[model samples]
Target: MMKYILGIAALLFFSCGNKEDILLPKADRTIVKEVMDLSPIYIFFRVNGKDTLAEVNRKNSISTTNWILNIDKRLPLRLVIPEVMKLQEKRRGDSAHKNEAAQNYYSYADSIGKNLAFIPFTNVHYKMVKPKAEVIVFFDKSNKIWVNGLMIKNDKFKNFINEFIDKKSENYQFCFSEDLSFGNYIQYEIYLQSLKINNGQEFIN
Candidate 1:
């Protein structure tokens, strides 16, 4: 499903194919505005410990039935993006592709195009480096907030969600859904309440 598009990418790096039968909105849409208000509602959560960006992605995939929080699409360069970007930036100094840095750089660039499918669509996922359990805060590189793929940063809302989870159910899981009736939509949040998660847990209908 399109909703899990970001989550799956976050979980693991699976290379399928460059060519797809994705039914992109066929409007002479020369320019699709990166409308902040029009962005998808990203759901992000924090468990107990500190983890790398790669680990966080895995958690997101595991908690497919959990709830979420939204953040702007624009991510901070100081975060994971910088490391990935640096991989490429350092390689530019190489006069030729004979250096290890250059090879790694080019490999990273190719991997991005193959892996970060949602980033291009403006869905930037975010995770806290050192998480504070009580303090549920969102991260942003700049003031410009858009709904990319990051989690929420509001204290009040974050607390509210945590409290809601405590009282409602133990599984603080959820996933996004779209209104296909219009062939497009404002995303809908689906919480996996009773459905048991298994090897095919994600196959829930």
Candidate 2:
């Protein structure tokens, strides 16, 4: 009877121990599982304002490479450890390249001649002259000029008219002419881009 009681007690102890072991949650299982299901190259989390190594560390409490492994269990341990340093170098190189490109995108105009005339009127004699005397532009609150069914170059022409045109009806007809020395005939067309606010958010004339 004593032997049977001892055997039963040992069996119960072993079974309970096995159950506890089975129930024990794996360390960082949530984080590990989340990482394991993701591919290494596309696995990304925003670290800072744009996405850099430091931001990853600050947010994830680990290096960027380690974070990669947490998502990709197939990653070699050696590769995971050096990811942060490598990413930092890559980020620095990318920034330098962008800066270089921006530096090269500058143009200086030595002489910008005023070679265009802008005229405002309700109705003017629509005549094409030999030298194209003047390009007459018409405008109300929402008017756009077009040539051959294509819009013109100036997006802020409405603002220019509004600024110069007098509110009084008597001064509604305004003529803007460039000196003949600028050019005999310039080829250009105007189109209404949008009926929206200018920089001041005021309705353009």
Number of the top TM-score candidate: 1
**Per-residue lDDT for 154 in model 1?**
37
Best-fitting candidate, scored by lDDT: 1
RMSD of 1: 18.8
Give the lowest summed-lDDT range of ten residues in model 2.
101-110
Pairs with steric clashes in candidate 2: 35-71, 36-71, 47-55, 145-190, 152-191
User: In model 1, which range of ten residues has the least summed lDDT?
Assistant: 101-110
Q: Compute each candidate's TM-score over C-alphas.
A: 0.21, 0.15
**What's the TM for model 1?**
0.21
lDDT of 2 by residue, 70-182 (tens): 11112221222244334434433564343321110000111122111121111122211212212224322123343223344456555654675344333332221221111
What lDDT does each candidate get?
Answer: 0.24, 0.23
Error of 1 at 185 (Å): 20
